[model samples]
Target: MDMKKYEVGESILFDIGQKILEAHWQDLLANTSLRFEKVLDVVTVHQQKQGIQNVRPKNLAPKAQQAYFQTGAGQTQHLITDFFTDSTKIYQQLKALDSILVRNLGPEQIIWPFSNRPQDLLADEPSVPPNEAAQLGVRLVLSDELLTQLFTTETAKQYPSFAAFKNAIYLHLAQNIISNLDILVYFFGAAPIAMPEASGVKRSAIQAKRFLNCNMFQDFDSYLLSLRKAASEPQPKLLQAPLFLRPQKGDLDYRQGVQYLDLQVLDIQPNVADGVFDYQVQFLKLFLLFNVVHTTDPEKLTTAAQRFYQVANEDPTQPSQARPRVTAYLQEMREFATKFFPKTDYQTALDKMTQVVANETQAPTAQLALEFAQSGLFQFGQQLAAKNQRILTGEPYQLRGYTDKSLEIQQFIGSAIELGLNYRFLDGTGEFLQLRSQQQSAIINARITAKNPLILQAILADQQAMNNLLGFAQVAVPKGFVATDLTVAKSLFHAEFEKSGVVIAPQNGPKTAQQVFTTPIDEHTFTTSFLEALDYDDTVVVKAFIPGSVYDFYILDQRILAILEQVPVNVVGDGQSDIESLIDQKNDDDRRGRLGQRPLVTIPKTAATAAFLAQHQQNYQTIPDRGEQVFLSAIADLAAGGDSFDVYEEVDQSYQKLVLRIAQTLNMQQGHVAMIIPNIYAPYQPQPNSAIVTDVAAAVSIIPYSFPFAGNQRKLSQVIIQSLFSNSAKERADD
Candidate 1:
């Protein structure tokens, strides 16, 4: 990157771009003898052609830049093939790192192209926040007014459509990207920089680091308002769960002053990783081992633990002959347990299990170990002192436990063993997609944990085997949930297994179909997408296309339009009603009996919090914070985790007819459902696992789009489900 002289109205902050490149790039080429000047010229040429016309070209010479890139697609290359043999592995690793960031926040979260002028911002101590609330160091840098101005009627008229206009405006603003928030994170956030000619670096989240799009927790004020509301409400509704909303704070210096087009930056401290990405890409059962990863000579730890258990159980004497490995494994297990929950009594759970295996020559020691690993109970029971330390980085999320479902997981394992289909979770999606490194994390309530003990043996194998071992679909392991299944998986699949699972057609339907009808401005026709088009707050029009076979399910009597919204009873308002009164009123009237929040059984610091809100202009009788509204308009079938009621029937026949017509317009097919989300039911509901930044340690559930692959969550069924469903699938004789 060349140091460019700015225009009369321009400024250049810190050369963060260079620093970013140094950290993520320099190492790969430091020892190489090749020159990178031509590569630099190409990059410079494109950069200038695109938008950066003001940059100085001298820094990007023909010689200094070619050390890494291979420019001119069809031109012959000089880079040696000797080092490229493991390029796939290297590429996969980089992708893994990128996936980690995206899984936590999002693919769009890392547009941190940053540049601070003359002074460095991160170097400052106790980073000054833009808001009065110092706790949540984040804020809204851009106003809704700006978006409106960019994509208003005038721009839409000129462009012929709103979507096209939006894209054009976004591009225009991005072309001239400049924000302190962007610069700040670009320098300090752990985003890797691009290597001049390295296409691989740009494969994942890290690649977009150069865009400088500013996806930080800039929407702090909104998040703060949401959090405070969550606190004031009786049931801190799941709608306002830590994930969907940003945390609250008290400092107030944040204002992206109207400098370049009055572009202001908001600032506030966050309680969580507001831009958290890639937490639930895969699910896995976890097992933590205290002893050596590999079995040792003399006797395995299980043998030792078995002897200890037998002595402790029977003789309580003559303990010298006990297996030492078992005792060691048990000690480590105890230490792990102590980390989360300390108990001075009965310190032999691990030891006893191992000892039982050791004393009985025919005992299934390996199978037992595999069981704990798959069930992940050991990981669950123990807590992490530091949330970032990962013992298992890439393991499959599967059913494991002492239940029927476990039998399924085990059966799956056994089938895998017999068929030898190379299976893994954190490896890659197209191949061993089920077992890739991106989703593996040994964290709390993880769908997939840090390590797959069953994989320990497989992973420790040679690299050739690891690379060739791809994932398969034409197979089902009914015993995937089995506790004592240790069938070594092979590299093949059964033909019948491939065709047995349910087939869900990818869902697709009408968008906000824009039709210029005369009634859009006058009649207020629900048949047109215009009702949803002009939506101002707390509303959404979910368009689903169900086949006729499922038609009755939609029109069920128990089906009320379930308004899954952020708890609206947030502000009772005025001075007449107390919080209890408001809570009672809301509970009595709302279809949902108890709010979708943890019960007020223990309000923690309820009184103090109320007093604090009173200090803010909010009255104790009235609600304060109002989080942005998000509603899930689903049928209230109870079984679908919704309440009961049928209010849709009360609407005028004309309205009902229009609703059905609108559904038809959106390709409703023969089966149409009635779960309408009127402005009345709109509430600011936050989605699950929204606490990306804050509650990294908490075991929050995963939402559909929020998770990596679609079916990545089914691996968490209880033990009984695993044992019965997983291990029982009939095996075919492909042998």
Candidate 2:
């Protein structure tokens, strides 16, 4: 488990079963009992035996016009349940099924499809009795009376009476089903066609909606009461519900809760090749986990279901058609998978699904749809089945570990290890490490002993002193005056404002910029912020507010190692959600986790956030129009939740030269320089510039230079270590 050696797109294998229909060319295979076997943790289909009795005409007919499928007398129809240990095994089983079908019924009789839509030939079939059709569709042959008797006997063992246990079971199932019905429908809804007059309903409904109605029951007792009422009432609404979890001899049972979920909503399409893809399996697991952790009122379930249906029914080939909420949910699921299956290639599957949702033409679904459109469905299925068969016996998948840290640190560590550099922990906590080469060993957290301690101390103790040192050396620095009191600070702010907009910051403190004000000088606001800065430090500095993006460059002696551009935290409104909701959504991103665990820090709901909102004449309840951008904070400090995008490659030569001159003037071996530039790519240099310098020891946070929010990441720590080795070698040569 060295996480450094782990691959990015790897995931663990799991054993799960997915339902699919058995077909020979265009004909369904009926009454087939599939047997499974396990050998060394790998499960496969051992045998497929035909049932002793054939499906009667009464059993094959549809109970209602909206039923999933309808068949004539003696028509063979069966659903295949494929059990697999992983995606590769699922592919193998699908290939085996294809071969078996082709061998038994000839190539012309072998049809591979993913949807469960009924055939057009069965449209004129006779109507079967509701009870008989229910039994046949789910293969639940046991009578309700017999099932009740058995379940009651089992329930009496665990409770005072069978009634109590049955109620509890119904309650559990009802809550889970009601809360998750919307997502379930979205995932499995495939039937989109229906006869209007026969069902007294116009258009088609999702497969899940074909049978189950949300208006049926309020709780466990009500569900049981409804069943009794349905048995006596002719043409009861409950008779047409899609899901069947009643007392039965099949997947579901009252005594056993839900042993299996029979989803009739899944549509059979040729593009899926096999029954489903690897991402579908991953999504199902995450979807179940999410349902278990979150709960919603049953009243809101219908609205959620309708929203999901609208999105699901849209042409997935268009990215713009995809709802933002659904896309956000998918991203959250991917993050959840990374936590649960850290050693698996689950992220790769999720990434592919994301691309599919985003309407990438290269995705499997879109690509297959194109092939189907170009060469017809049957030909596309045949070619895809052949291709799938070829890949069935490929190499077995190996799981690898996943790292949760920012990508830059991972790359730096990987590169360091590749270079054969030996590193040892400098502290027991493992925060500090000493990296060693033959010529020198560099301390990661303490890289400033090479510079004079007194000079570094003087500069860090006062911002004005540092500005004067840089200014005396003819290097550009912001013109500013210090005030020891609020009255003096206000006077200085007004004076600065007369010249231009003023910026107010604590003169002597670790995080002076955290509460800094970058607004036009006003008596009330300036006095307020000035007083706030005094709470942290004794003095405050008032200067002109520079308008540009802040850039931070790391310097080892005189050489620039890396540079980053600071981007303030902001949110884009979609018009549908309010500002508070948008902020919540942005904070929900995995990259914005607490501490330095992720690249970007989480946006905090603080007084500053409210103040920023008030300054813009807006509040948390305000609904910004679509495409509107709102800033959440004034200062662009990563510590205060601002984002940093790398600008190392885009740094102009003049900026680089300015950084080197600042480093040389400071007389430090290693340090950092912060500057403001109009354009990162532009060649213009700062004049009477607003910038600050931090000698290596005083620089508390240089990690931002390496792990920026956007642009190409730089291996800054590795660069620093390499510079140490180079400096040591040069010193030896001079000696």
Candidate 3:
């Protein structure tokens, strides 16, 4: 395993280095307080020693800069912890190897070392002292280009052979350290010696022991070694999710970018059977000798661990053969761990995952509520509870059959409890929520509407009856009619299109109390025939296609609460990547979550999306100019990866007044009204032909306003609370 005895090609070794670099970035993003400053300090010292000059550092974003210097001045003492212990020759040799890397690779090859300087760059300043340099760490940036330049023919020739070049760069990188060393050693030669003092992991090991409550171990490496050994044994038990608590000395890590850190499950690739590491690492599943919980609550830890084991036990014996099942088990464990962790922030990451999963697995209303929970509304409710001397009783629990596979109903109950209201299940079936305060009460049905005794009468009205009501109210809605026969629907659609110069389309589903003309026209069959493919039997309402952006306005009583502008799923061209590549990159965003999990939905490639692209004379292969926005779907639905913006402040007051007028005309004291407006922010102008009301829901979601994809955050929760508790006398006076 020694350096001289190992053999690896130069290019392969360079590839290994690149993988290590990629791993470093992942680790940096996952656990920002992993002592990356040590890496930066080592890089700076070597660069200075090599006399590399006339270069300037890239001005990293403020948050990124904080990540590099998170450890602060005190933690850097480990750099020279045992300066006297090392033989001068060993130190000089390590330094020399690192210096050679800098000299040969040069500034162009090392991105983090030095970016291009401006013309007015000042002369070189005196170097900081070794200790001071460790405190003021530099950025640790490594990219694909950096490694490519290292393996160039000219650079490789600088050494005696390719082996010499490989050894130098790998050894240099080892001193600075990169994540997932097993991958590195699998491709590169012998693993570099563990310079504990230089890496500061020796000190970190002691702190980690106490933080993880594993004081019996000498350091982090020993603890990991113990876990690794357990993982290999027969009848091994799954361990509780572990934590990587950085030695922050009671303060939060600045690298977190936020005031607190959520319980993070770092995806650091585990060590292979033969690879060795002398420091802490991360993995999804853990196998341990004894019960060890990574949180303040042991009960929660045990529960999550037991759940993980249940899945594992149910899984087919060989996880390697049951890859999907194993992935499911791991995800199950992660969800429990992430959700159960005590929250110091407004909403934990699990909420985002829950919404994403709900969108994939549950009803539309449940998805809307869970997504809305990710906003400050949930936190606001909790804060309100704290203020009112009410304690949050428990975590979200699911209601079977009604909100099955989703936490929306549980969220509503939680919010009600937090608001100091008493709640009772109307019946054993748990289909309704009866939330009451001393002053007032309301009974909410499964879909969020206030339950009314006459609701059955309203529900019995079909599409034509509803349209007649709207017509009587004189609302300017899309013009079309319902037809039972496919041929008649198509003929009517064609006639409407010819008259208005717009296509009339049938909706893809059974009509709801409120339906919108948001779905694109199915040009394939020119009717609601797409639904027939899904075996749908109900008649659909055909409406003239209204061309413009979709705007949703939520109104309560006389006040316009919030307006949301929904944008179709689209990607802006980056000049380099084709449409397909750009989509892949966008989907790769961490916020996109695993498919079926989300802060944002993962964009899907469907036949509809393809058809939409074909209509625009574009396909996945097309590479548009930079900044061009290419729409993938004509439908602006969030569930389909469309984006929403909080446009309450941006909407013109005249438009707000107009929406309110329509709401009043419909006798909608509380409802969501959607309109087709060319520009939501433009001054309102009378365009009876162009602007039309598309949809109206008596009960609508608060998600788009609270957890929008873009634009300013709005507090729809507050609006709801106010509406619910507003004084009857004052409301009457205002009206």
Candidate 4:
């Protein structure tokens, strides 16, 4: 085959676009330029250094006007138990946990006072220096000489800098790590406590104590009041601080208590890879009231949560195959739960897990293999499901091909121990398949596991893959087949020997598989195109099942294009208006905030602004160059640090016809001009009350700006004005 093809977005290595236009090698290669991705090892990132301040001993706090409860309004015993309060209880729980995964933490692991900090004590030495100072510190703790010292003994115990280095690394990883999602366990070495739930050192601790008296009826109101007060304050507090001592204000702020878990992937095909996987683990501690017997309270819960967190936070190896560390973590979990919360029992949980395995139901198509020995779904799949036998009646197919011992589904999930056996199939497994095409002999690992096999999804994907292999194309269909990757698909999408789904489909005639996507365009063509694609002598998957927001990423391109199509117009005003007073006098409103009466942005009253310059010209009292056009855009709800107005911008035409086309395509308001008032800082954005009208697209959204300076950036003063649609232009301005 002498054809060439290119993956969307990937630049062709050679001049294929021209070659394609010339029809070079289009027949032989079928335009399949053997597209392949060079698999990259995970990228490792170093975290920025940040300071940590944990004012210890719990007794510190400013006095409050009202009495606060510290021992907790009696239920403190049932939940997050802190063993440190009870020596005997602490020892007992520790002994129990030791049975599962014995830990050898030393004094260094404990919370040391400020006076003992190493940076304040030891001379400068690199992390892995070999000397008596290092040896003494090394043997004093659990690590061998090979393990680099995270912090010196003096540093580990003393103030200010003791755990600062470790906490900084942990924070760095937490902020940046985006592991492949295959890794189940992530560990961070020497994680210091994330900040508490409060702020203003004294008040934070005060807030922590008040948390105890919270209950159902009075509970929610109390939290709301406290949050309001917390927000009134300015500085950000750390997340790791226990709320009982000091509360970190924002649970949503991800930067606090960020930690890195370094790990290596085992069972990779190649011997060596380019990158090191940097991982992160979040210890989001929530404070809740749990009713418990005084004998079985929170002190135990707190202790267990900490210990469980600690074990899980142990540093990881490069490709942890044996994962003694991970097992140790599981063991820690069992030990912690069984020791204090013995009623929850270890065996009971393990036994219940086996139920997850036992519930596996056979695939419905297994009957096909039973009836026609040599053919299973393969017969129908090869015929593109045109055969009537492939049609389903009331009884669903019990897919049976994934569990064949010959194929060994265990290989994918062994590290995580997600040995799926149960029967959540209906609510699970999007689709199932064991496609065996000769096109690419390379075998890939399953990364998305299913609670039940995703039989339908797999069949669709396999069908599409086979079709693509056959050189048939699937035209773009709106809201078409997009894949929702479930962890079960990656972990337990397996095949076994007993009733294996791994059988290779026999050679069939050439077929094509195509995937389609769409935006907010007229649904008429999209609907027809989708159904036609579905029945195109191949297979179709309506894009519903694919989860998350991956669909949004695709249509953003259309969004940009839609913006470009709007009719361009400039801002202008009434013929008779003073340029100076016009800047301030433009019809406008101001809102009250934490600060009194702030105009959302530079709402132009003057005429000198360029928008004013272009629109009025010398005729409108010599186009006052002082201000800009203002849209009735609400200033502070969601975007630009505001909320979604929920009010769709009014569609207008006339002077803003261009705005209408762009807005309609983007589903935005056609005429509302979202203006910008640049703060002239690092990053810039539209001023308050100045968002360009958008549509349902903005409804499904994420925060557009997150960097530090997002708030202070200046707004854009000039912007495009356009009509929303074809006919509405003249009718708008007359109103």
Candidate 5:
């Protein structure tokens, strides 16, 4: 990597010409009729070093070289050779450009001297040949087959003239130079040349004003289209001219008397020995460009890009500082991409996130791992592991060697890790995970456990018994009866179901809303018959359907840690769109994805939804009035398409106190108590039918609070870990 210093000049005319060339190439690519897959391949190639090699004429076969040399700068020619004198000059220019890597910019701001510029130059220097100018030169290897395919007369008719068609064919040889120029401005040390009086806040404000005048287009091509449609609006000036690094001091004497952005020295230097900086720069460039290509507004895109750059460049050595910021940026970026380009070609960019997963061995499990890792939950596990010297066996974050763990077990692992509890596979098959500390341990199979596992069986098998105990303690519990058979179930619910619907579910196992039957008294016979036909002999709990939203109170160490309120999956209507269209738009939210893919499950539009809508005198095509909310499901089960909100603080403190009393009655160290209440935000009262405790379980999930779909995120994992650790410490002291 030989390098030489040169007195580089800032060539304004050359810079303008370069920008025009890049813009022209961009327009050509955007409007071309060529297959996008081929175009994507070409764009991808331009981003790689190897791609450069493939495009060089000398690297091609001798026969191909002959075709390249025969091409001329004409309508039929397919080569770019206007600026370069020869191939040797091309190599010299590129080699000099790469030297920008060596520049010792003291403080990273918005500019740097060309890497080839002399380290020590005078304050007032004159302009000379630019050393950091990027030049892309190539000779197209024309084959008989390629010529026939590209130069077809039929293709010529699509354009205004044969010359226009030939120009389009020739443009294929032009690399995506605008992307390269952006790389220089962002990754390399090129500083943008500013207008005479425009710099800093004034410049930004002016640009923002101009941006507001422009129509809010979805992308660059759309922005171009808007210019033609809204011809009445005054045309806005381009924000800044593209400029490369040059040899100059702090002042602007070398700018040919034109004022430009003042260059600053790069203050912080990075260790580039391992190519880490290079990799980061490349990834950041691609990531930002993907957003830029998909983002709806130019002003927003610029702000986001600059914000990302600030986060990355703030402290390169301590990347952990940037992790949280980067995570926030990516989350916003995901929402933006999902909302704006749900069905566009660029939407595939979101699909390509697997490449970033880095350690994803299996698609399903790795995806879950990736979600927790990004949500900041893994940070708790990582910090704990580092403090305890325990081995966490997964890849990337070291949780396991394989991905065969059930989704439930995977979630438990994440929770256990966050709680600072080390886990061991009880058997070689990895079917069971044992979460333990020095003083206590618990086994988690399909169901997660608390510090005490003995009470789990009784708690899971009989919700009716738990409710009876809660009621005996004078705690608010749902009024229900246990039915041992179909006859008993019908007898218990026959009267109540006529006034309000009754819910019947198995009493001998953990129940899901899907497994429960909710029907009116007239419909009770059908449900009772269906359960009997399935050979369900276990007693079923028959309870009057509580009319309200459901809230799950997480009790840890005999106290209410958090409360999560869930509502049936629903959409609000705008005046113009049908319910079906509204659902599509709502489902476009990235957070509302399939189970295990995101924090929230997507609202399903199925037969059940159609039936539910029909019950409300509506259908999928029904266009409800503005500001109307239409629910698609009857139950507030996340897996069945429901939204959750953190109501831990929102719930009245009196209700919180009552929940603690209920926790005490259950004697739960860790448990979940679900209640159906009309309004959690209102203060609790001892009314006979105010709130009904729907279900209680010994095992509790922290995910609802850990990565909440809406409202403030709660750190339940940390709280659980600290509490359990304290309990273990107290027991050790007693010993």
Candidate 6:
């Protein structure tokens, strides 16, 4: 098979294990600190006294396999199979390993119940030597053969010799590993605490640095030399490198090529029976692929690795203090993965990583610690084990969805179905769906597919008629006339200047601020904006610029379903971090990304931001005083990096009645009404003496209204469905 056609390589090896307490099933080993010596004794004896064969209990059934072994520490480490290629197989292997462990040790001996952190195990334990405590976590070893094949296939023609190809591959892999070690730790680091205190090493949520030495070799030769030296010259302790090029032999001369990349940084999540998830495997594959293609300086790679390690250990969920190069590298990697793989599973994994990076509270270790802070370690461990077991057995514990969109959509569908409404997909694409009852029916994404000529004509040609109808109803609209010529727009701006600031926008189409302006209007500015607007529409509506907040009210059958207040993208400063750091932190939010899956857009450091900074006499490095809020841009649309807050509950009840009246006047049973309000919370009141209805859309982007960053989450779709059902019931009652 062509390598290019297959994005994912085959048969990556996984060496995952569980660390269990040595006490009996009934023994409540409440304090890991006090029980460390006993645990160590059990593991030491298991390793020294019992050989692999003798370790298996004699009374165990033949079907029950024994994969458990003792690490240097007393904890039991089960070497689950090395033949994992995908999630399903890895899950099967984990299940098998779990069955064996349960048969032998029972379930309660496992240490981490809800987390992958080693701190839970060693927290109260006496400080053991570092070497003795090594290898207690899970390791993922990628196949050298597969990696070599990938490298040669992609760049074989460029490099003639096999040694050159191998060397290049080694260098690339080294760079990739070094650069991503911090990220690896973020996802897998479990040792947050060290027993008794290791000076200079603080208690971190990520403990990979404790055992895994992150020293990177300059080349393959140096890597092999270090390994050979470690084997030959007796070191006082075992080498603690988390990542290294495993050699095929004991000597350097016999080392033909690198054997495998041993990745020992991943923490075994206590509740996950398999230490790894399928999505994680997909991410790793993409990570490797990205590194192979993108080259970087070794020094930069090292710096990034160190920086990431620090950030991941401290708080992997937030924006790091790493340099722009390091941050860009991660963003590039994620983009590359999402682009090449393009699988829902891969996207889901990426989403999870985003969530982790955005919200520190989402980390399993943080959650477990918070939940079990007062509970004994043993009880915490037990609860975690039970939770993991439940997950492994396919018992639903927490409600998880692919993304926020899917989660909200699922809720809508579930609610609609419960109300005796029939729902069906209008197309195979699943994007368009219909809800029906005996007397009424409503279509979502109601587009002209099998077009009715009248509907098409109304949408494409009757915008002027809609405006005239709104005008006839005595509705408050922008006080301006439509201009067919740029010269006319200039005159209108001058005529309206004394009364209100003039605004120029396309009359019958969507227009961005680039082609729309609110002024301090001059003839030149008016002409430029009017000409741009004319390109989109024959006529331009030059109106009075009403200074107010933009409020969007979703209307369903003359009833107001939801209201949202649009606020331009801005950041509140802490006394510590600079403006740039805060912006980076805000953009790191999972809700701000390249995909429109989020509500708020990413505030890029564009020319607009620079201008704003300059106007405020602030640079990226400027540390704002505590409680100072800085606006990033003037644009206040969600697409323009603005955020929306739900104001339905806060806004006066009279605003809902007013919006309903407006919707009824327009005869728009299902549409959105956007108006300018001086205060969003007090929508019925206007400070500028007049409020203007800016625009109306038959179809609107409902996402912002449904999932506003602040205030109550409104189920507009569900409300629409409910209204249809209600209308149907009312019609039946009349009959």
Give a tens-digit lDDT track for model 6, residues 1-735: 011111111211110000011112111111101000001111111222221212322223232222122333233343433334454434443444444333333322332332223332444443543222212232333444544444434324454444444444545566667667666655554434333443222224334344333343555455555665677766612365555554466534523454445555555544455545556655655555455445555546557656655754453333444434444655776775554444436567677666665665665545544545566444565565556555543411101221223333434443434343445555654456566555576665532111122342364244456567666765677766777976666666677764456666676665344332333646776777678878887877666666668888887766788888887778889999998899888888656764345555687777767766786688788888889988765556677677788887777776677778877665567777788766545546533344567777765666677667778877565566666567667777999
Query: What are the runs in model 4 whose C-alpha is more than 4 Å off?
Result: 1-218, 236-429, 432-735
Q: How high a TM-score does candidate 2 get?
A: 0.42
* Candidate 1 accuracy as lDDT: 0.23
TM per candidate:
0.19, 0.42, 0.42, 0.17, 0.45, 0.43
Return the candidate ranking by lDDT, descending: 6, 2, 5, 3, 1, 4
Which segments of model 2 are wrong by more than 4 Å? 1-416, 446-454, 485-491, 494-500, 508-513, 521-524, 680-682, 685-700
Error (Å) of candidate 5 at residue 399 is 9.3
Model 2 per-residue lDDT at 544: 63
Q: Candidate 6 has which clashing residue pairs, if any? A: 33-124, 33-125, 113-384, 117-190, 118-190, 188-267, 317-357
**Stretches of candidate 3 above 4 Å error?**
1-411, 423-431, 438-440, 445-447, 451-463, 466-468, 471-474, 498-524, 527-537, 589-599, 725-735
Residue-level lDDT of model 5, residues 571-686, one tens digit each, is: 89888899999988888875566564455667777886898788779999999789998888667777766788888888888777777787776666677878877777678888
Q: Against the true structure, what is every candidate's RMSD?
A: 34.4, 23.5, 24.7, 33.5, 25.5, 20.7
Against the true structure, candidate 6 has what lDDT? 0.51
Best by lDDT: 6
Q: For model 2, how does the per-residue alpha-carbon lDDT over 542-617 read when each residue is reduced to its tens digit?
A: 6666667778877776778778787677778998888889888888865676554555778787777888889889
The candidate 5 region of ten consecutive residues with least summed lDDT is 35-44
lDDT of 6 at 366: 51
lDDT winner between 5 and 6, please give it: 6
lDDT of 3 by residue, 1-735 (tens): 111322223334434323434434322222212111122211222322232222223221122222111222322211111111112222322222222223222233331211111110112442221212111111121222433445464435555444344334433332112112111111111111112222111111111111222321322233335545656978543232222222224332212111111121111111111011111122211101001111122123334333332322221111222234333533643543443322322123334333433343232212222332354222322232233211111111221112331233444543443354555567665547676666566665534644212442352235566556666766577777776676776677666643442333233343311123334444454544524523443455656667778888877766887788888889999898999998888788544642222436789887767777887899989998999999887667766777888878787888788878876665666767788887665777665754577776765555456557888656554345435555543555688
Q: Order the candidate numbers by TM-score, best to worst.
A: 5, 6, 2, 3, 1, 4
Q: Model 4, residue 601: what's the lDDT?
A: 26
**Better model by TM-score: candidate 2 vs candidate 5:** 5
